[model samples]
Each structure stands twice: as structure tokens, then as C-alpha cells.
Target: MVKVEIVEEKDQQSSANSPYASTSSSRHSSQESISSISSELSAEETLYDRINALVDIVPPATRHRISTKVSKAVSFVKTGGKIMGNIVWIVTTSALLVGLPLALSLEDEAKIVAQEREMMAQQQGAQQMLSPGSAYPPPPGSNQTPQKGIVPPGF
Candidate 1:
């Protein structure tokens, strides 16, 4: 319970004879009034206080049910977050494990194709050299017939 009092304003000349007459006394009274106003403002219900008051109005059984539902909702959100995090981790790990090896294998296959092309080019150049109108003629005493069944060294 609280009680409030209202005082009527008095003329300055009349107040000049009162205890609040001196400059220091007037300042002190002003400070007191400001502090009292601040205290009254502070005494007003805050948002949290109002919410608590509303909650107190509900029946105990209803309050319990509401709290339980809220707790479950919070738990569900936390669990869903953890599950999403795990899914992301799994996807990233799979990409590293499977995709990395696949990329490396593709690179190796490309190298093999390049090597095969180089081998074919070399074979073509050797055949050109052995042709009749070749840049270099055969030695004077050697047989010019093509050799039939000899495989190249690195084949």
C-alpha cells in the first residue's frame, strides 16, 4: 500500500521566510524532489515483473504444462542444430575421402593418355626414318630390307 501527498505551490516571497529559504536549503530540497521522482519511477512494474504477474495468474497445472512444452521446444531446437552440424561434417568428410581419390585417379589417367600419345608419335617418327626417301641413306655395304619381328626395347 502507498499514499501520495500533493502540496499547493506558494509564492516565492512567502517561501523566502521558510526553512527552505537559504540557497543551500533550496538546493537540498530540489535534490530531494528529484530523488523522490526517480524512486517513484523505479517502483513502477518492469516488463519482467509484468510477465511474472501474468504467469502467476494462471492455474498451477496450466503453468506446468506450458513450461513443459517450452522446455521440449528448446530441447528440440538444440537437437536439430546438432543433427545439422553432424550432416555438414559428414558431407565434408565424404567429399575429402571420395572426391580426393577420384580427382587423383583422373589426373593419373590423363598422364597415361599423354604418355600413349608421345609413344605413338615416336613410333611414327621411327617409321618415317626407315622409309626409302629418308633424309639419311643406308650404309654402303648393309642390307636395306626392313627387319620383320624385332620389338622396340621399351615396348
Candidate 2:
């Protein structure tokens, strides 16, 4: 029949346009993808349900004990934090109140002592320069003779 030949010709054209195209295979692949997506969604829901179900299975006494232990641990951590904070505050305050001034005073004392030593050295040099003796006196602890060409042992 002419209609049958037309349908056969249209099918041949479709196959020529795309050699690998097939309606059955496309439907099967789409079905597989849809089923896989649904399975994943169901798996997630099942996991959520399982987790929510755990709340009903624990006994009240066990839950109470767990809660009490958690509360005690929290309180202990809070107390320790407060104590450590107080200790740090005390140390910093003491350093500012006591240690800073002590360090400054010690540094000032050292500077004063150094200045006095320099002044004393200058005074001794001036006294030596003003003296009328032709030769300066030997230092108290000296053992070396003051001969003109004498060299110290190390030098």
C-alpha cells in the first residue's frame, strides 16, 4: 500500500539522520536515570529517619546521667577559664605596678653610678695634670720598674 511505503520511507529518513538513535533505548536510559535519582533521594530520607529515631531508643535515666555529666564538664571548664583569667590579670597588674618601676629605678641607679665613675675619673686626671711633680706616681699595685725602655712581659 502507498501508506505503508510512506511510513517505511519516513523511518528510513529518520535512521539516515541519526544512525544510533532509537526510541526504545532513549526511553530505557531515561527510566534508568530517573530510578537512580529516586533511589538516592530515598536513601537520604532513610538516613534522616534513622537518626531521628535514635532519640526514642535511649532510656530516661541514661539520658539524665549524660546530661548531668555534660553540665558538670561545662561548669568545670568555665571555672577553670575564670581562674586562669584572674591569674593572668593579677600577673599583668603586678608587672605594671611593681616590676616596671623596679626595673626603671635599677636602670636609673646604674646610670647614676656610671656618671659618678666618669666624674671621678675626670677629677683624678685633672688632679694629676695640675700636680707639680715631674713624674707621675706609680699606681699602688704596680710591680713594674718605670725605666724608659722597659716593655711589659705580655707586650
Name model 2 segments beyond 4 Å from true. Answer: 1-52, 132-155
TM-score, candidate 1, is 0.45
Name the top lDDT candidate: 1
All predictions: root-mean-square deviation over Cα? 13.6, 19.9
lDDT (10s digit) by residue, model 2, range 84-107: 999999999999999999999999
lDDT of 1 at 82: 99
Candidate 1's residue-wise lDDT over 109-149, tens digit each? 99999999999999987886667755454557767854556
Give Cα distance to truth, residue 135, candidate 1, Å.
Answer: 16
- Per-residue error for 57 in candidate 1, Å, reads 2.5
lDDT of 2: 0.77
TM-score (C-alpha, index-matched) for candidate 2: 0.54
